[model samples]
Target: MTVTGHVKTAPETTAQVLSAEQRHADELAFLAAYDDGARPPGWALTPRAVVTFIRGSDGEPLTLPAERRTGTLPATMTVAAKFVGERSLVERCVVTLAGERGLLLVGEPGTAKSMLSELLAAAVCGTSALTVQGTAGTTEDAFRYGWNYALLLAQGPTPQALVDSPVLTAMRSGRVVRIEEVTRCLPEVQDALVSLLSDRRMNVPELAGTEEGLIRAVPGFTVIATANLRDRGVSEMSSALKRRFNFETIHPIADADTETDLVRRQATAAVERAGAAYTVDDAVLDALVTVFRDLRSGRSDEGWDVERPGTVMSTAEAVQVAVSLGLSAAYLADGDALDLMPGHLLGVVHKDDQNDRARLLGYWDGPVRRRAEDGSAMWRRLWDLRESLR
Candidate 1:
């Protein structure tokens, strides 16, 4: 079958990445039956269930009431946490959506802002495909509507010729639409959403006097947008647009141990997906996380001052570094994963500024050397490998 002008293909079994909805289809279905409480219109799961879906069930199995049990779903299930943040934050996001208000998640790069948006959309609407990836060239058509030139010319400005943008489609269907990196879009293009959100209706002047001309949003329709804090000055959001949405700041994982575990879990999954055993040692992983946290926060675990890199040393980047280390350990038989750290770290630090290399070297001279002096064998090895930074 075709959607728009393109043929829709069957699900690729070997897809490298799956959307939140596809990855957690079973949990969604189970949660739908698991929660019989009131749900906002067009929502697949109740508000509470939506929260539970994103922030797992804390290892406790939830039993489906016998009356609601079905053959496809198990009797009892333990929901797995997909987004690693506070349950209260997820609850606030759900509440915002439930009220049908526009939600804007603002955060530093790689803070799982997009991941949280996808998870919430999937839990609420049963699909996370209605999305617009904002960029410098994005235009009003992306947030409002577009046209099929062929259909427009052949049939005139009719309903069939009008192509629905993701936001428009979401409005009509009463589902959630996600705008990723909203700040990347030009200021004028970003304004398209202000009126749309405020009015909850879009006037298609091209189709004026027709039944489909004025498109009104149905119940449960909402918008979820994400903006990276690093992109604040790129295209600052207008006050009007900001007022239409409830803003939530997604912070990086606060606890070092939690961040380390997340990095390990995500990196291991990444390596295994590449068909390799993730054999990176725990000690190496701990040291790697320590380096990332120290650089990102500009302070060492021991409270020693360290220079921050120009490039954001995000957890997501740390996971990639861990994945690289794991792959090197798995494939490169002669090399230790610990020995490969300096080069990968150098690559991350050197992204935006070459001067960051000096900062990285300084970190080694301070934290790594001090830890080595404190008799940590792992830190000692890392210290010995400082020449790798050059």
Candidate 2:
């Protein structure tokens, strides 16, 4: 099915990554056509369809009307599942957005919290470009609004002089606004969201008595913020700010097969984007993901105790290691990338803390030695490569 207006028409560039809206425009269009369920105010799709778009269909084909199947809109289109996690979580998130409530996703780093937020915003509002990246230095201007210095100096605090941040714009347009790493911001800076969320309005004293100063959020305005639980104690959210959001915790991929599949898919995409052929073997990816899971959980699959590293052994790190292994193979013309896994893992483990080396070595001495003795050739090879870690 050819979707006309919504699909991006720009020429494909190697390095550019399209937003969620542009990437799945056809699937969204298909769902919009097939289901005519009622949508909340300012939403592009119904709540149910939004969940379907994120969780994917059960291979059931969605048939469109014969007349509407013109250019890119085919007669039948199957929606591919975007998220690899729980369907109930996606439903809860969709319901929260439909109710115009703030949603906060907290998890260990690399659990795809940011990706989920982007997809949810795109599905509900038809755009995910409105975003605020919270950091230690993030000021109130980021959450509220800023003034155009030149316009403000010449005309004073007029409508044209007011510069809208993503939050303010989302309020006026009733769209989803994303705040990434909310816990990274200072507590005072984070508190700026309390009044805007509770009152559903942004008051600008600079332009008081003007129509532009008192900007009330329309019916569909909502916030989707993500925070890394690793930063739990640092710049923690105030009780008031926490009360405004419906919290959801995104756990790391539990099953090894699911994690390996996600790593393969994401790594292949990364490799292709780098203009390199994907040559990483499945066995190598499986081993890589297994080792990561073991290190992250501080236990071998067989229940041996392993010391966890200070660094986060997240799926994102696994994807990076896979991509690096693929790139090494592509450039060096190496036959198999399995041999490079140990070195990549060593690099990942020793990232921020020098003491993590000892913890990693503890893992190599315990789990790696045990797995080697268990008759797995890959584990045996990894065990032999333990000297490389020193």
For each candidate, what is the lDDT?
0.90, 0.88
Residue 214 Cα positional deviation in candidate 1, in Å, after optimal superposition: 0.6
**Tens-place lDDT digits, model 2, residues 1-390:** 222332223345854789999999989888877777799999999999999999888788878888667676789878888888899999999988888999999999999999999999999999999999998889999999998999988998899988899999999999999999999999999999999889999999988887876889999999999999874445888999999999999999888898999899999888766666677779889889988999999887889888889889999999999999988887676556877777789899997788998888888888888888989898898888888888
After superposing candidate 1, which stretches have Cα over 4 Å from the reference? 1-12
Report residue 335 deviation for candidate 1 (angstroms). 0.6
TM-scores, each model vs. reference: 0.95, 0.94
